[model samples]
Target: MSSKLANPSSDRGRVGMRGLRASGAAAALSVGLLVMTGCGSSDSAASSSSSASSSAGGEHSEDLKLPAGWKHAVGTTDFQGIHAETKLPTTVTDATGASVTVTDDSKIISAGDGISSTLEALGLKDKIYAASKDSTSPAGKDAPEHFEYTKQTGTEGLLALDGTLFIGDNTKRHGSVAQQFRDAGTPAVVVDDQATQSEKLQAVADYVGAHDAGVKLVDSVEKDMAKAKDTVKDHGLQGHSVIQITATGAGGANSVAGTGTPGTEMIESLGMTSVGAESGLRGLSREFSNEGILASDPDVIVMAESDYQKWGGEDGVWEAFPTLKETKAGKAGKIIVMPDAQIRYSSPEIGAGAQALARAISEN
Candidate 1:
């Protein structure tokens, strides 16, 4: 029987609050999303195009150039045939002096923009798997085979693999599979991006990598950002207080937002500030205090389209948050449904979020 997508709401099952708290705690304690730079800075050439370009059949043939500490893990995984038509580095050196060769085919399991976008950039789709049950593609649904095993009964039973091009960890704020790897003695490669810095996005990546499909599912968030840069710059939302709110999910946190998330990044990119960002520095939440909302008095409100629908759609948030209706943005209908991906995951969706914010701001 083919497995179906699991709803995020009922995903915890009996593990409920304990699991969430564990996940949350685990997410808080761990660190090192990127060995080097912050969101705005570039680590190394390898950090950007770790995949080697130019394949046997005119595939991604771009030269693979990485940083000093990162090595390529080629032929390590079972990437038998898939190749890209771009120039990617064939190898990278890790911090431990381990040399990893870039394989023509690497198993990519993404929970964020870095993993999926990277794989998509190289045009390698067949090697992807799901360590977690979360959907990688925004519009398209994922299958069971794409899942990563983040939630194991004991840390000992964690999935094992030759190498992983990992992104995000639900258990780790960096979203890396390092701890799980430490438990299992599995050697894994981490590709940290801006999204991985966010606890929510990182945890998803951690879930995907633990499933042992880390390399196959990598994303290219930089590329996505590049694509949306023009859109954000043109919109000119500078000096605006933008707040991102979504409908309450199964957890029931409404009018709340996440910190260090793509939404926050989008707001920053547009020269806007996230209203209650400081209070929302940890886990994702929707408990927007009325006073907090009033204090923010944002100029714009943006949300994922589906999330918008949860509260009877865009109309619902407006109706429920009466004060929002009185705001300049609310009155002007300055609401937007971000591209499907941005609302779902914080990974590569930053670009989409920026675009959505830009559009809403410009239009409003």
Candidate 2:
């Protein structure tokens, strides 16, 4: 697989729901609110200030105020739009230098991953510019108005970026955006929405200024996975299998199943078995299947939470597949409803998604 296949889509999804344009969101993460405030819509026309320093020569590291338990890692990278130098941790050491452990690999990017959350964590939320290109979630169709604001502002050049995070399938429409960043000297971390296990999470770390961020994310995932494994044992879900079907393209109501989809990944991550990697159901009515109205014969069924509600939740899925209620997963009450926000393309959120899946599988 291409490296791009393992990366998240544009950083837009990281803040797509809460607001923040494409490049702007990333720029927000890269540059910070100090430069982005009031610059999203009607340009503020303020003269450039030099508050941000480059990661070169460790200048960025000097300004950071990390969490009480956090410390600088071996390496550093520019974070947010501020180009503030940030470092990741070298070891999972706590204050006592004992290694911290993480279990699951369900990836998640909270508001804390990009500009919006970083600023808030650091007490700079009020300085956010809130401008962004159009963004649309599975729950909310139609991309928002500020979809490509980062590209519009030439953020790629200003921050001197090296990588980006993408959430969905690679399309020319959005691929061009990645290309734009690449052309401007930045690599991208792309992930498909159908990706259930979020194995591609490391791509986000590739862009994080600190190697410690990668370590932290990975450790967190490991801890979550371990917890999931325990949950599976507690629930006796061993040797179970599952599948995920998805519809791609505009209104092309057809269905197909694949190993790449999120639901399948979720099953495998929990140590459950699955059908052939290439095996899947395809070609259903995009109108409904896209919302998960279609059914598959798996031990468990999982769908985006928003789509679950759209499909009428458990009642709707049961009505659509009477057999589902009879299946091991279903009878055992294993239907999973994922948070729509977790479905988007953010690095930090990948861990959160993994945790959710672990919880779903272990609990069910």
Candidate 3:
């Protein structure tokens, strides 16, 4: 293994909201569709890899129509799995095709994606050494190192840590460099199981040797999600109309949390309607006009806390879409912001995300 590791970053540099919309998130959404559509067979990955196609959200009983070639990529109630223990120095294979042998799990560093929260849910938070500075999850709150992982992670900095094992998000972001970490002698594991929550948790458990913990975490997730929905329903927020807008989107609220993406699922779990899904979008999201927002006329709108801050908060939203002031959400000051992890990835922490989202909209 070389002491120096090649940077896994591309010339484009830290992928931004727009860049991911063009590539990475699209990759993740299709993988999610595989799971949501019951493509859980051993060969589902092969089917997902063949093309980016949307499937109906089979898990949801609603008549919601997913964006074409996109499927519901978040929010689930199922939580059943076989329990197992792992032997030390186990070799795990990443979806990106790299097989890693993990000898230690003490000094873990995450790209600060949803997997960071998943690690915390797995009771491995103390093992995390560093994470993304932009992370809003509890796992990164006391992290020793807060790196600048904006979208996709860079592999070059990880080599210097001399950590025993590395975990990354391949289905959504930071997936292209599994081999790079392998060359550096650190066992690199990517959360590549995208078809189902059970499969996803087990893959991560196998890599970190925490099978029992992973199984328990699933039941916890189910309970938490159920509780979140019940809480929101108690508030009489069910059937509420809402739309999620990304700060990077133009025309203020034009960037949508469209059908089949985590944002839409989060919205639904909170007992709200996703205008993005109702509009019959073709992919995860697409730019819409202010006129479209006026037509949907949602009761409230939401944005990611990270993106909101990056864009400069209230003033930013107003400036991005001057016409938004005319919309119902804007007029009533019902615009809300939630953490990035809560609205982005579908993982074991989805229940927490749902709970957080429930609070955000309920309070607003």
Candidate 4:
């Protein structure tokens, strides 16, 4: 676990999408505006992989003390190949209320890891041409091309992939590109930045022609949540306070999850309190502050593995922010760490993320 820490693939989007987007950057793995946007003949065969792709390098273990019902995320999310689309050229109304008729599920680009990871849970991992880089996760870890959600770029990257459709998160880049990708023959289906986890899952699933898979994926999320919360309640750990802290990359901008964000929802749903939420930091995501942390004095301090490493782990965090020593979590040494991808991306992995977090809390 110590050896596998990769810097976060992208910054924790400060915007409404929760670190999935960068100011103007593009995260084009593959997507296109097809029939609705007059898509050109794009030798879609060029984009399809002949065989199923596996994680790049190899699967890195987080060494999580997973709860009873949860399995390791890699092979388990494939749904046993249950893709249930009935027709081609299906019309999908994306998060933006725009319609796109997808012609090829064989060639797809997940503009963000949210879509990539969600699609992987839907058993469509083989169809993904690329995914966000450094997404050490339940899925998209092996997506050959490193997808980036920061720094807006031109359509050269999009056109090169020759993908049939692009699934993106609603962000500055995703929103501003409605017609850019369309004009490039890439029909983009942007998922709402603020959609619930299930809605986000259903959006990408629908775009990729996996409505049935989407339902199952959503159900898995719900069941996982129920199990996770039960574990917390069973362990007598409900309402424990937590604050997930993440850096931009190694030693980058420090941020904390607040109210209305996936991190908070996951925490509260598991019957715990988010320090940021308790303090009324309503930005959904907000800057990390030593004074604020001391004020709320959470029960546990959650950190992304990369940030944990950057700060030289628990001992280092205590030294750098000596103020942490005054907090309840610090006095008890309840510092926690998890994979960056699970906590950062609001995809199917979130439930698994919560379960892992729950397991950690029960231990604490």
Candidate 5:
């Protein structure tokens, strides 16, 4: 497999309702007013509300409301909302062409940090019976100990989990394992690895049968993303050249974020120009040499925190590529190292990622 296939950073990978009586209606009205005050809409609030209402149905439809002044930073329409009334025992065909039946109470095992992050964003972290060891989210930090599986754990470890449903990417390494799960009477939903931020949110919502929650989650993230972008623009940080690199071995081929990669997209979303895109690099990631880095001479260098640590941290990066010491970024001491999971996956944490990048750019 190509390096891009082995490490496609573009894909990352989502709630509840209840009954009420006439007296409950009065209480709900009071609470709704409070929510409106706390999360009022902006000028675009009418359009967002219309779009959200048109896409939702069922008991939670009435409860689904976008915060005022909401707008998507990446796309025009929010594709994350699932049908509010969608019940369990429904069959969904995943990107792998496998039709899996899911129920309201299904115990799910999540693989990949991308998918796990989505589950956490959708307030369904409790539903995960087992999660990859690398899973990290704002909802909790004990997912690894709770389920007991890591990226190094093979198919056997995953199969050992007491789960009724599984959600993950359909990579060569896991395709057969997913099939085995299905054969063993466990339905596995294989999400597309290249899915966009909105698509990732929708996939998780579809599996959990909570479209309304998915919409809300997307809206919340998009709002944060917009704020991050505005912060970059207001700080006069737009158009700064950036390159995101992943360290290999000494003199080995290094992978850099190119066009269509999550890293590039995130940087561009913050109003900065990705040097990889400017250099005509395509695909998810491209192999580059030291000479290429010298030629591009980016103003900023972004990398995964693990890679930064692997190379002995900030000083080590300069040691790995002495030529980098002469670049504008090197002179300014601007090497932004972020968590691999956050930059590599497209999940709700994307907003946080954008904010971090924006902060880095502003400071630099």
Candidate 6:
């Protein structure tokens, strides 16, 4: 029961409004996607060949050359194996059409959770000087004492950091702040959050001069994804209809995860069917009404754990939507609660999210 991919334009109006509010007018105005291109070549070939040989012969190789205690810092939530490499200076074309160059020793300020996670994976957490309050990445959460976390830090705060490079989604920085950074000689690279996971990882890696680490992380995530799919198949939960809703205020703002969206991708990858995708909704998520939920009648209800807690957990959800009690999911207690960070951000942790979903479905 593989789910059909939904058309992206099914609920354009709803998704558009959400996107505009999340990213801002300037980012919404940007049309083309950002491209990350390498400028110089390092001894990557030699290093890769050596690593391949060592692994092929069943020998352990210290290719990543990770610093002591770095691996533990990354933790087991989404620990992709490390790969060592030399840093190279490169230029990246951001979503806003701004080109920013990065070097090995650049002082960086991460403004988004997605980029912050990538930097942490590359063992470059110490390089970050500041981040936004919305950043839930390991580096962001454990941000140093000197790091600042705010919704919008304004130009003065950014200038005060004196960072050589700024990495974040376009929504984090307004046009004037971006220009101010440029005027001050510190270039800002605003990544497209809607890009594929691999692209986002590569863009962040290229900006931070950690190409090998990025590749390894992507590979590890891909491998874990394969295993997750197998787990879903083994549990006989393929094509299970799932609907994810977020509890916003009293009414509970319903948004359907459509094709290409992180939630849809994660659900589909686990061999489950996203009701939102099946209905031809796409692009992040679209506002869904109570009528829509009743019509879809999903087999499973997925919501953020925080949202669940806010809604007074399972009992609260049932009380709010008695119609859910009539659905197969509610009758069987199939509501799955996932962390907001795992479902919201396009990071390697998505693999973990998929696994968690599969486990929950199996248990149920």
Choose the strongest candidate by lDDT.
4
Question: What would the per-residue lDDT of candidate 1 be over residues 34-103, giving only the tens digit for each residue?
Answer: 0111122223333231223212111111233322322211110112332344223335433233344433
Candidate 1 minimal-lDDT segment of 10 residues: 28-37
Q: Taking the tens digit of each residue's C-alpha lDDT, what string does model 3 give over 184-262?
A: 6667777753334445656677678877767676666667767778768989998777677665432223366665456
Error of 4 at 203 (Å): 1.5
TM-score winner: 4
Residue 325 accuracy (lDDT) in model 2? 57
Model 6 lDDT per residue over 1-364, tens place: 1222211245542232223333322111000011111112221211111211111011112232211111100101434346435365777667667776766434677766666666766666667777764444556665552344344544577678777777765443444566677778877776665577667777777766677777877776676667768878998988788876655411224345565556677787777888766666554443433334454568887765445555654456655555556667766656555545456556656665566566656655
User: Considering TM-score, which of the candidate structures 1 and 5 is the better prediction for this target?
Assistant: 5
Q: Per-residue CA lDDT of candidate 2, range 268-318, in tens?
A: 666765432323322111222211211223565554433433443345445
Clashes within 3 Å, all models in order:
85, 77, 5, 18, 9, 3
Question: What C-alpha root-mean-square deviation, in Å, does candidate 6 show against the real structure?
Answer: 14.1
Worst window of 10 by summed lDDT in candidate 2: 28-37
Each prediction's Cα lDDT score?
A: 0.40, 0.33, 0.55, 0.57, 0.54, 0.55
Model 5 TM-score? 0.64
Candidate 5, 230-321: lDDT as tens digits:
87888998888887776531122345666645677778878887766655554333334444455456788777644554565445556655
Residue 118 of candidate 4: its Cα lDDT?
A: 70
- Which 10 residues in a row give candidate 3 its minimum summed lDDT? 27-36
TM for every model, in the order presented, reads: 0.53, 0.45, 0.61, 0.71, 0.64, 0.66
| Full candidate order by TM-score, most accurate first | 4, 6, 5, 3, 1, 2
- What are the per-residue Cα lDDT tens digits for candidate 4 across 95-195? 66777777877777677667776766666777777665656554566666665544555556665777777777764457656556677767777888666
